[model samples]
Target chain A: MTTLTETRVDEMSFTSPKPKRRIPWGSIVSAILLSLGAVVMIAPFMWIIQAAFGETARAFVLPPRWLPANPSLENFESVFEQVPYGMFMFNSVKIAVIVTLGQLITCSTAAYAFARLEFRGKNVLFMLLISALMIPGQVTLVPLFIVMRQLGLYNTHAALILPALINPFGVFLLRQFFMTIPKDLEDAARVDGANVFTIYWRIILPLSGPILTTLAILTFVTMWNSYFLPLIMINDPELQVLTVGLTLLRGQYGAGALGPIAAALAMAIVPVLVVFLMLQKYIIKSIVSTGIKG
Target chain B: MSEQIMTVRSLKRREAMAAYAFILPTLLGFLVFVVGPMLASFALSLFDWNLLTPPEYVGLANWEKLFSDARVGGIYVNTLRLSLMVVFSNMTFGLLFAILLDSKLPVLIRNFFRISYFFPYVVSAVAVSLIWTFLFNRDLGPLNYYLGLLGVDSRINWLNSSQWSPLAIVIADVWKNVGFYILVFLGGMQAISRDFYEAAEVDGANTWQKFRNITLPLLSPTILFLLVISIIGALQIFEQPQILTSGGPGDATRTIVLYIYEQGFKFFDMGYAATLAISLFAIILVLTIIQFRLSRRWVFYQ
Candidate 1:
């Protein structure tokens, strides 16, 4: 009877074969639609790249060429010749670097205080900082412009850099990250007689490599792409950043100079694209976590 | 033991002082830049003073003008229209893309799609707008060229016509910003537990029913957040219209911020501009509060 039962079980197992693999039609459709959407998303940049490298006259022609027939560097040369494109690029880099560094220092310190240390009015101070986020920059634009001019900062990079150095959002982001860090390490340092600044610099900042990098990239990109503030504050062509400078270039040349304009745009976009591609994981994560625009 | 206690107390005091020192820069900046300027702008609204002239007390003159200003009325309408279009398209497309991305696909292809979608967000608005101008060009732009091939014969004056210019601004703004909404929504959707979907499947729920019952409620908070921010951002749009149309075809796309800039800088009506700025601030504040209050009805915390 035992031999018969064993044979029956074996037969049952053998009779029931594995299921056949079915084609994932849903997934296939999704992939195709997604791929098409992705092409549409990047199509503008593709057009710009084609125009930037292609002949100037071909930019407006019917049945626009997706690929440059004879690529050349003349449009790029024209961008520099037409305006101080290099100066604008340099100004953008300088201002972005200064503002990013300044925000990291100021925001990190403030965040440490808010997260780790206790003091009088701590909650009130934090509330004040957060409230400022709701106040649109336009509310301050008129007075800030007046202040900048009064302080001899008009038409200067300092006007652009000074106001952005201490972002409330940055402070809030850093504070949240700092609070997530375990207190045991900090307590150990305190037992060893480490001072507040010492602990912040050595313990908190070093452990905060990821958040700090995120904030740095966010601030850098914001400053690099800032247009309105620079447009209002700086009247001098020499002081203008890339965004304002590109507009000036367009204003001077109008639609007739599409090639040079495209070249300048390519120049402006390439550095940002390179930075973005390299650190995209962190950038996307930061945007998701903070809800801050890049 | 008393001496040791005193030493600890002193150490705590020192720590507090150190904390104060750490926050001083931000505190000072806040006071100088944000707080001071806000107060100054409010005060400046009461006076008429261009940069080159002595101040004259306006005494609600600008306020009265703002109410009666016909152009201001039209400009506000245009601004609202543009914002509505942009917010609708952005949210719809953003949610669609996020849902599409949530489907079964290789991780590699997912990243590629995400990066491609988000690439334009990082680029300068001015540069992108400049390129858009070319694309919107009447006769030679690829947009019209493609349309012609698809059986349309006439060229659309996208930047020149009042009708088309606002639509063009909406397109450019949505193209640049929808990526952000997509990522945020994707993040929110991914955070939903898979167990719920599996349970729904066990109950014989179809894909749409599962999504409608499980995903929508869970993602409500994210949707609310995006709606509030997108409305605020859309309302204050400056670059796309300023670069594309320059509020052209007669104040068609002149946003509140653009109008403020023009009043303050172009015409140098400083007092009027301050009043406009205050109105914008009030509008945003009210909208944000209303959104939060309304979110209580629909937004699910979990």
Candidate 2:
């Protein structure tokens, strides 16, 4: 009789009203912590934005203003007057565009060959190329400088463009992506009498839009932001890119005036930030997948 | 049969030729830029040359100077110390944020934090460093002002003082870079099987226990990958310190790469710079090998 009564009680409990959902304190706390961290992550950019538009004198005041009390474009005008900011931007764009397009063509062709075509010593060649990734650019910095000078390419944009035209990492990434593509598409194209180049140019390139965009964005950003090579290779102010130009601006005005320095930095950073925000999902996914940038 | 075989051979030959043509550009670049320079760097290390004069054979003098150079030794030590601090802070915060994001938060909120954290990384280091210089200003900067509000009266000489300069570099570097680690770590954590967690729960394991056993053991491979890359990158750090402190208030933040640049460009000592580059390569090579060897003990492949 006692066992039967216990069974009835258990059944009643099963059919009883569901208990109220407990508050998720753990999740709430995690969210709060993450939000705080996010602020710290973006605080510097905020500081730069406000300082860029504020009066130079007000920029350094203690308990800094969160927003410019009276925003002005005077700092940007000073930046232009102080440096050839326009030339710097143009040079940066030209080099970055050329490198990005050049890499797309070169990397895709090589990746196609490695992924689809059979050639002698292919494995050995691929391995040799991949090994270049391990050698730091510093190792070649001295010798490459000499080579550039000897070739009379020093102090020219070509010095930056030529070496960056072919990245081993890009080849590796595209090759991996190419291999995942179904072989049937290429086989079909071949059956229709398409040549190797035709197949790669038409079918493979079309299928590779996403990865190509990823690579283009990466190459563009890298080339745009590249400082070390340009700093060493090009000394002429006329040929200077934004990164090296900003340093010069800093040297002149960084101490007493935060406004002009901040303005130049804002100009350099805004384009990249806009691109990043627009395509963040792809950027994040690509970084996670490639895991090679470092 | 003979005709058919001939056609087959001709077709194979054509394919091979096409393949060679396809790879020719990259192959040429690889030879001239990568292979040629690597050999030339070592050869250049054996000679002395400034841009103004003809090269002279110095045998192993540059290498000998490397061992005796007091500044080089301290710079290496500084590089290693800064690298350790940056790597530790980056990895810790990276894993912490990844775990936090892994919680059952709304997707919209998670995305917000993700984008905010990663914003700094995509910007130019030069630009990022410039922004940091303002914030790290000793007297009127916001950091010190905020600290003052918290009851600290003394201003921290973030960029000017030797004691705080390295820490400033680490902070700026981690702020820009920790997001990369977070994304990588989050990817690694998501790649882990949910079945492991479910099984642990059935076994009556607590949250800490589950993380300690299932999450960590499974996350070991990712940990090792990030570790090796972070160390390598940290060792080669240049832009932040170069822009922030210019290697400092007396070489307090001088890194190997910066030193190499100064020697090669500023001082026009190409041979010594080449020697330093070679030493850095060897150090990185050995350290990477050691890490991999040591990883065998703790890295769980699954």
Candidate 3:
């Protein structure tokens, strides 16, 4: 009877489940499905890289190998020879840097004022900024082109840089980020006789590194990859950024010169990709923090 | 006390001045870049001007031409069709993928998918279009090769057919943007309270019911916001169609932005281009306002 009771206790007691041996069916299904989707998402990137380096032409009879049989630097060399590739890269870097720096100054200052300072017509001004944010860039395209031409900035990098520096989006984003900073920090700084600009410069800014870095990277990427503005503004091949140059090159070369163009495209994407990878934390963090208001 | 009051008043004056100074850079840019250009665009719409010739005032003639033009209807239809396809599909797929990613997956696998999807958003549209061209090319495109292997007709022209061209462009555009919408929805999903789900589970609610009641209701604001953003952005889409089809074999993918661009640059009809721009701007504004008004019925606020 005691042995029977012991056996009943053994049957009743729970055994620790073997997590490793038991297949994680939920995770397995998700992985397989998402992996399929990931191929769809990432295949184009691999296509460009292969096109840049590989000579595997498309064929209906057989699928070309995924990896290159004979990868070489010839396509890149050809790209360099055809366009002012180096100059285009320089112009892109220059415009992106200038615009990023300009946005930082303008956005931060305007955001600080909007966030911390009390002024006449503050709400109205903020409302105006919001309205302007809704105005499509195309609506302003022709007039901005006219204005830039009038100011003799057409076909120049400044044409691309100046019109863009007034990003209401940046101001709006920074203002939201700035609003989250504790008012006490500024008040404390003020007690030490810090002025508004001084406090914004010394205290608010240092505390806003994540958002600011995020904005800077975004601005840089936007400017780097900008097509519409550059396409309209700069016609001179010498002043062309990567987007304008690549389009012009492709139009001229068509399908025959895929290799060089692919190389150029690959080169064009790398910097933004690198920055995105390195500082990805800030990208997600900034959006998560500010998306509610947005 | 009198001296202190005097100093306080002076300090208030100084503060206002500092505020204005702080805002000056943005204000100047706003006037010179944003407001001034908008005013100029409106003014330009009233006149006939080409870069070669001086501007001539035509009052509402350009406006009349735009509204009454036969091409505008077809163009609008194409644009609306393309945009709605992109907006709806991107939202559905983005939300779907984000939900999947939010499931019980390994952190590494989840992060990989997130980056892989968002990769396109950062790259240039022109570059993206070039890749699409190669993939869609009839002679050597992998799309055809893969389709043939799947026992389908292999010699399809993806970007040329009127029926398929716009859809092709839409696919590319949606692929380009879905990652961004995923980011937005994922953020919204993360912000929701898990307590509601727990309570529902305790009350014997099934997964579907819980999602329909709790997740759907809670995510409405983000949905509405994404809708507005997508509509506005899709309305302005130029580069994809421009790069892919140059507005098509025969205006199959001709959008309003392309129309504006063609009139302004290719035809050098700045006046009409400006008019078309104003019309588009009006359409966008009205649509956005309508969306905002419509949001009240469904969009939940905390």
Highest-scoring model, TM-score: 2
Per-prediction DockQ: 0.73, 0.72, 0.52
Runs in model 3 deviating more than 4 A are: A1-28, A55-62, A287-294
B1-302 in candidate 3: lDDT tens per residue?
99999998888888889989988888888998899989988899899999888889999999899879999888988999888998889998988888878787678867888888877877778778877877777767788888889999887887888878888888888777778888888888888999998999999999789889998899999899888888888888888888888888788899999999999999999999998998898999899899989998988965
Off by over 4 Å in 1: A1-25
| Ranking of predictions according to DockQ | 1, 2, 3
Tens-digit lDDT string for candidate 1 (A260-289): 898888888888888889989988887667
TM-score of chain A of each: 0.90, 0.91, 0.84
Candidate 1 global Cα RMSD: 3.0
User: By DockQ, who's the top model here?
Assistant: 1
**Two-chain DockQ for model 1:** 0.73
lDDT digits (tens) for residues B79-179 of candidate 2: 99999999999999999999998887678888898999887778888887888888988887898888888898648999988999999999999888889
lDDT (Cα, tens digit) per residue for candidate 3, span A159-183: 9888778878888988998999899
**Candidate 2 deviation (Cα RMSD):** 3.1
Best by lDDT: 2
Q: How accurate is candidate 1 locally (lDDT)?
A: 0.89
Docking class of 2: medium
Task: Give the per-residue Cα lDDT of candidate 3 at B98.
Answer: 80
- In Å, residue B130's CA in model 3 sits off its true spot by 1.2
